[model samples]
Target chain A: MIKGGFAGRILHVNLSEQRTWTEPVDDALARDYVGGLGICIKLASDLIPRGVEPLSPESVFVLGVGPLVGTDLPSSSRMYAVARLPASGTVGWCGAGGYTFGAQLKYAGYDHIIVSGMADKPVYINIEDARVDIRDAGAMWGLGIDDTCESVYRDLDAQAGVIAIGQAGENKSAIAMAFVDRISTLGRGGFGAVMGAKNLKAIVVQGSGGITVSDRKRFNKLSRSLLNSFREYKYLKEWQELGMLKAFPMVPIDVYKRMKERRTACVSCPVGCKEVVRIPDGPFAGLVKHTSSALNLFTPMMYGMQDPWEAVKLITDLDSYGMDMFEFFGLMGMARELAGSGVISLTPEEPEIDLTSFSSMSAWAERIARRQGTGDLLADGFSAVLEKLGNEAKQHAPALIKGIHPYAGPGAALPWDRFGTMELGQVLDPRGPHVGSGGSPTYFAIRPLEVFPKHLKRMGIPENVVDRILGPDRNKLHVGRLLRYSHAWFAMLGSLGICARGQVNRFYNADLCAKAYEAATGIPTSTDDLRKRVDRVWTTFRELNIREGLDASKEALPDQWFRESGFKEYLTGEPLSKKQAEEMKKEYFDEWGWEG
Target chain B: MKYEITYIQENCSGCLRCQLACSRAYARSFQPSAACIKIESRGAEYRIIFTKDCVECGFCADNCLFGALTKTPKEVTA
Candidate 1:
């Protein structure tokens, strides 16, 4: 039996054979790798062979939570879902937090769940305590995420947490995500398509069991002490009200506030950063939906539609169809660019539709989800969209990192508006063109001198290292060194089931996290110990990518970001030449112990 | 005098931390379903309903980050 915080069980479900089995997690594995993303990555490396198709039955999907998840640690409710990304075919990892799923799984006497093989027909997995059932999802198939969740809840427990995909996954859209309780999602990596390939509709978990911590008193004391910091967070009220939207600052707050009906939070989160709005009495009356995200909200606004209600509608439609907002936004921008250059006279299948309007974008998004006509081409991903649109569209096509869309590459913004560390991390991420992989938060763009120490402290870097970086000329501080810390820090958090929100990091550091871990799991861990474990996990991740023949040689930012004109480095306001950019990448790779 | 955890519904962010805290205090485990205080959401609003299981312990209010839940001395006991 597993002691400490772990339930000691690894539930392996094979849909292809419709069999389920439980094995005791090797204590050595937990001791060495920690839990969640760490264990998931280690398992994925061993279970999945090289050159295996991501969507094939041979590919694996691993869901795990850390030892802290079921404890009272703040923001401990998280699940790391990982797979061979169908979008980029690289090692993809998504850390998601919700109110119930991870905790419920832990309470159900499980440390992790590994699913492999494909089901013969549409189905969903139901887990209640020790009982596991692969139920038919024929009736619920093709339903939107919300409806599917509601229907599944009706058939099961209302309290059961549902991680279901919309039609986007059923159709296997590469950009589709696995939506968690209509609140948060496994960020990227085409995990939804992986589920669709398995014919798995949803995973419902409900547990009435208990989680035992090694030292409850110490755990409670440590957790309770952190509450003050969370409450006193400078942006607490703002985050509670605006969440991520506050970080990006899009459409005046008054605009969203008018439609803002209420704010909600994930499981065990002190910062309720999610907002739900209802358009009270308009042509679109009683339309209730949650905001997509900061960058996602920017998509509708880019088309000259500023109405918060309209944006909410577009976001909901995108979610219902299981469309990726970034990819959709990129496609819309490319289409407009193609049309603007007089390359193609844009004519809609429905001639009455204003092809440039937000509604038209929504129409195209829906078509992409359903894979109908023009949506069929666009749904195949950005490269496919460009190919069918011909050479003009290809020229206008935004540079994609690897095969997937870049969230915010250097080309996406003017140099001043862009972040150097973040952009560099984007290309370096094994997942390719993703932000969350590097472990830095979106709020890292704050005034450097003021936030540097705090950022360093949060990552638990030694004061000596901080002095080394910020010494002499703060302008020439090597950002590559900081990126190395970020990679390790994020890898550690992923293994620990910790949420990656800015405030969470601000309130807790590696020292406090070690205490929490030690108290929860009787595993004596210190900052140094955890740091070593992080290095191991990160090295293993890099090794996995290398084994797949995905290395730094293939990494490159868009040409626009490297262009010298109208560009300046974000930190020093100095011109960022192409040679300097190449040198920076080399420095980053060297920090990771990689050779050019 | 009797005191019970009192909730300001509007201040609740629906984080459910109070429920986790309460469950820990009562059940000695992290179980939200067994907690005395329940946070229900409708649109953007959340309602905190205290159940009979509540022992008048202020753990939930004490852990509430937004002061959404609080306990003060009341002269009359229910």
Candidate 2:
């Protein structure tokens, strides 16, 4: 028996051979990799052979939950899905929330599930305890995410948790996502498209087994105190109703208040950040929806829809089709700018190339999902479109860092206030560019500078280090040390299946998570120990990327985005200089002990 | 003092931290179904149900993260 908080089993399914088996999880592997993102990445690095196409049968997809999953610990419902993804052709990982998929997977007696090979036809996997079935999904193919989820759940148990892809994935769109419970997503990195390539439609799970801890009493005590702390958290009520909607400073609070009908939360989430809204009366009257993220709401805004409700509809429609809004916006933005500049001509079959009209955007979204006309060229992602368009059309390509749209860069609509490190974090992330990878600096961006010391201390940073960093000569926003800490912190969170959403996990830190892990698993860990483990996982991840021929030197925002445009730095209000950016990159790499 | 545990259904976020706490106190296992207090989803809303087997131990109340459950004294008959 492997102590506690682990199921001690990993299920392996080979689609090509139609075989299923379970392996006893090695204790040393579990200790070294930790769990979730760390373990999934480590496994993919070991099992997946290089020089093979990402969508090939040999490419492995791993979904894993950590030891903290299924417990009452705050934000313990998160999971990570990883693959040598088609999105950036890098070993990338995406963290998911808003359901009990991770918990159910754990309760079903699995630490992780690896799907290899490819099915001759469309299929889905069903897991209930020791029983695992590979069923034909011929009827479910080409269905929308909602329809796919309902169909699987209706045939199986109503309480069964699902991770399904939609028409986007069926068509193998590089921007496709895996929708979990129809409300949350394993967003970015295009793992869903890999699922499509493997002819896998969905994975349905249900379990009634209980997870036992090493020290039940101590674990219960830790959980109880954490719960009590949440009661005292000031923003709990607002977060319960609005989700991350509350955190967005740009959106008028009244707009969300008018639309919100009810609160629907992820499994085992006390914060209840997810919302269900009903449009009162308009062209889109009585449209009840549980889908809408900051990206979804803002993507339509980029298309010039003034109303938040219209944006809501666009997001809902996009989610149903299982698309990545980040990539879609980049495609649309580039298409509009290029067409208007007379560099490219959109064919007549393409939805009228009006980038600003909601109707045009919606029509275009459908075309992309269906792979019709010009939409077919753009559906695969920014890089593919550039390649298809040839040399002249490459001039019109959107500024994509590492061939993936930036979730936090100038490409996005939301005004992200970062203390410089977010940019480094985005560029350095293995999965091209992402907003959430860098750390929890959004809190630092918004909160008062006086509280920096307290926050650092709470995050388990030693007082001497904190004092040296925040000394009189040092600028308050100077974040070199903080950036280093943030990477390790988030990596650790992913390993432990902890959700690091700013609103829900504002007060969370390595110390608290370490305590919880020790109590439940009898692992006897500390904040320093977790940080070191995070460093190990991150280094191994980098080594894997290097082996796959990824060039670390070219990892940066494109020159045109910086030099061609005179955009002011977010904090300094001065135009960002190339020289300054280069210096920052060098400093960042030095801090992480990486070669420039 | 004799007390009654009142369930405020609206305040629950369906996190089930309370149920886990209760199960730990009563069942010695981390099973939500074994707890005295049950949180059920009625459409988008959550309803808190107290079982007859509940000992009024107040463990659930103490761990109600969102203040969805509270324990108060049972009023004496005049």
Candidate 3:
């Protein structure tokens, strides 16, 4: 039996039958899968059939938070959503971090909420403690994410945790996403469309119960120690001041200082990576927007949208529509290129495509959300575009990993000149193109080879495999072999509901995590045991995807990556050939004990 | 020297760390609603409220990283 750190119950909601049931969380399940995305993936694999269409009612949506979420652990307010994504047609997981949602769900006495089957009409699941109701969402069906959340707040408590979708999701746009209280995005591979396909609009949760740890005294000691370490962190002040803008110098510091109203952190987080920005003055004056990070709000500048206010306005509009900004921009960039080359032309009645023009982009957002005219084709994402336009369009298409537009790596929106674990993960991970850096050394920075051993040890890589990862040449590190441990680390962090971002996860080591887990859950877990559990979770996740016909052999680096003259291997500083890239992929699979 | 808890609403990042810490100290569990300190959201800003039961043990203040809450020794006039 589970002693603590879990709500110890799983809420299963069947929308088709309009019924709900609760299942006890068994020790075997918790021990094998851990929690959060690990448990979610396991549940999805068991409940969702292999051949079910991604957008069909048969595809299940699992929302889970780990044992550490409701406790006083720093940056533990993360939740994961797993489903067969409509954009990629692959079972994938996406996570969101913010205040209240994950903790509130735990307080409601549920570690995971699994929703399956379709509702007869537009509805939302209102969960307040044990009372779960499928309420009518007729009035909120067409509203934007902000409005839907506000309506739920009005209907329920203002402090209630709400996951809401907008017009794009209602229309089942492949790029549609759901927002957590209009602050953090929950889905990237169109989980929102899956929710929409089920005629679901939102999920509101409120709980009055508390989360207890098995050994409160020990847990408190660990928590306080971790908190103190974060407090003493040298970069804490700068990190609080700048958030992610400190890492990626995308926006001007003066501009960020002028617009940033306040920094916002998730529950129990010292590093507040999220920010609330206001347009101080201009055409879009008095516009207040809450973004996960400043990087997202200023991303338009990377594409030549010069005005900050315009960028904010465009992003806010996109958020309201519940569209994935990365996919929208990717699709638009490709469409604009094709249109300019006369490879694809807009209807005479449709507005001209110009990514730089806010008005044009705004119109395109609406058109795509509503699936109007040319927007109808764009709503289907790259696969449809490739199918319609043929092989010539493939050359102009943006780098798509797992059939979705990539947000990182070479030729992506946040273009990097060198290859890293994240770059490799873009193609390797079942989920397409995410920024879960997994505490890898080559996430966004190039570090010295000497640092690899220390970082690898911190990531819980066994000493026996350390030499293999370092390889015969002590000067160079094998990225693929290192990535195997990186994935396990990411899985472990996600399972614990810990923030995997560098700012927070940097302070966490495997042994510390193991001790904390033992204290919180009363589960006797050694560092090695913790590593084994996470590796099991990742392997099971991969095996499940493989069962669903996700062929590793088919995965490849986009041609556009090699075409870039500046792109080079992060470790070798030499241009990586296609053969070398393939070898790296093979090494990753070989390390996983899978046939390459 | 006696310490008094002081709150700066502007500095609060709405993380609710203070509330969680307060709850843990008082109830041995983490529950924001059970805490003496509450962070109520008013649009973009957060308003920190201390309930009647707050003894001001200073745990909340200590846990607050943004300096939203602080415990300072009372001034003694000469």
Best by TM-score: 3
Model 2 residue A588 lDDT? 60
Q: Which stretches in model 2 have alpha-carbon errors above 4 Å?
A: A156-158, A292-295, A341-344, A417-419, A442-448, A460-472, A476-481, A560-571, B1-12, B36-58, B66-71, B75-78
lDDT of 2 by residue, B5-78 (tens): 88778767667777777776777766676788877654456788889998887878776656688889788797
User: Candidate 3, which segments miss by more than 4 Å at Cα?
Assistant: A341-343, B74-78
Q: Write the per-residue lDDT of candidate 3 for residues A331-356, one digit (tens) a residue.
A: 99999888888888799877788888
**Candidate 1 lDDT, A1-596, residue by residue in tens:** 23577878899999999999999889888878888888888888887778888889988888888888877778877788778877777877777775578888888888788899999999999999899999999998989887887686666523677788888888888778888876667747578888888999999888777787888889888987887778777878877777677776767877666677666666677886665777766567788776434335445665466665666677788887666777777666666666678765545573223434667777777877887765566566765565566776677777677766666644442123445566667777777776665555323554566567777777878787666555655444555666777888887777777787665766778888788878888887898898888788888887888888786555775666655553356566676676766776776667667774
Best by DockQ: 3
TM-score of each model, paired residue for residue: 0.93, 0.93, 0.97
TM-score of chain A of 3: 0.98
- lDDT, candidate 1, at A56: 92
Q: Lowest-lDDT window of 10 residues in candidate 2 chain A?
A: A410-419
* Per-model lDDT: 0.74, 0.74, 0.86
Candidate 3 docking class: medium
TM-score of chain B of 2: 0.85
Ranking, lDDT, top scorer first: 3, 2, 1
Which runs in model 1 stand beyond 4 Å of their true positions? Answer: A291-295, A336-356, A384-393, A409-416, A439-442, A471-475, A564-567, B40-47, B76-78
Against the native complex, each candidate's DockQ, computed on alpha carbons, is 0.59, 0.47, 0.77
